[model samples]
Target: MAAREYGQYCGVTQALELVGERWALLIVRDLLVGPRRYGELAEGLPRIPSNILAARLKELQAAGILRRAPRSRVVVYELTPYGRELEPVVLALGAWGFKAMGDPRDEQVVTPDSMTMALRTAFRPAVAAELPATSYAARLGAAELLVRVDGARLDVSRGDGPVDLSFAAGPGIRRLISGELAPDRAISTGVVEVLHGRGDLLARFATTFHLAA
Candidate 1:
């Protein structure tokens, strides 16, 4: 009951047999952003045909990559606790691809790029080393954003109280941690803007974390 493939030595190959089909990984990636309804997932993943997307969601549900939950009597696909466990795996894959391309000086992760996934991957023990007991705020256009620290989680979209800082980098929240855009330059160009927080605190916080490219 090991689920081992008789002739497969590569673990990835065997795993792929279960989830390596077309657009399957993308489904998993979208789920990592947050819980989304079937229609929402389809909207986010426009390249996927509706019929294929539906099929893949069903397959993922069966394989435990996603779980179906009742949302207003309609089934919605959500990442299970087990499925959330794959965030690191997908992030690592994205970072590997970025580095493998051999262009460190450029912003490898761009808009419509999976920067959120990269940030999710990069926000680990090493990067958050000495994480001070402080919160961060990002002032996105027309939306006040706050990321409060809850142990290992960077709780997003709290949108509560006075924002400590602001990041106005379009929709690509993932680029900040993906190492494609410099935190400083991005600020200068208005892609990111810090409205509050002590400079010293911000500097220290910046040093303690990094976006995995």
Candidate 2:
């Protein structure tokens, strides 16, 4: 699986050689959230060619980054302990790229897994440590997420649950996350719709999940 050799005896070169193939790190990103069946991965990455997905999966498995294992009697792909070490790297990279993300393209669609990772990337544990615990039921594009911030810990998952705030946002939500739009301005400007909770909590949400531009 070391097909993309750089002829350099360096760790960064080796790392890229293992996962530099297009769509490889994305597969790792999705699995970092949780185990996913093959079909689930396909669903998350709608644009990935089927053959490419299969080939990358095989390559990653060969690299010992991920493994297929039984989950509820069905096989699912999950990152190994070694692969789990990539979490911080992925999150840091996401934060770095986020600074340059001005707006979404016409064809770009947010997936649950991607949204989950985005939340994780922008989470401010130190800020949340000073704020009261809060839970949010957030709908971003087509992704529905339950986000809970308890002091310094943040938890996110799919589906709805008891939440202190519920809101829906579109791609413009990035403006709020980037602190370009204030919470009050976001709600008043129709960038965010308060569905079923105190709108004030949206301010808390903004503070807790923020990535400075």
Per-model tally of clashing residue pairs: 4, 0
Clashing pairs in 2: none
Q: After superposition, how far is residue 102 of candidate 2 from its true place, in Å?
A: 1.8
TM-score on alpha carbons, each prediction: 0.69, 0.97
Positional deviation of 70 in candidate 1, in angstroms? Answer: 0.9
Strongest candidate by TM-score: 2
The 10-residue segment of model 2 with minimum total lDDT is: 1-10
Candidate maximizing lDDT:
2
Give the alpha-carbon lDDT of every model: 0.62, 0.94
Name the regions of candidate 1 deviating beyond 4 angstroms. 1-10, 100-115, 126-129, 139-145, 150-152, 158-161, 170-185, 189-191, 195-205
lDDT of 2 at 212: 78
Clashes of 1: 4
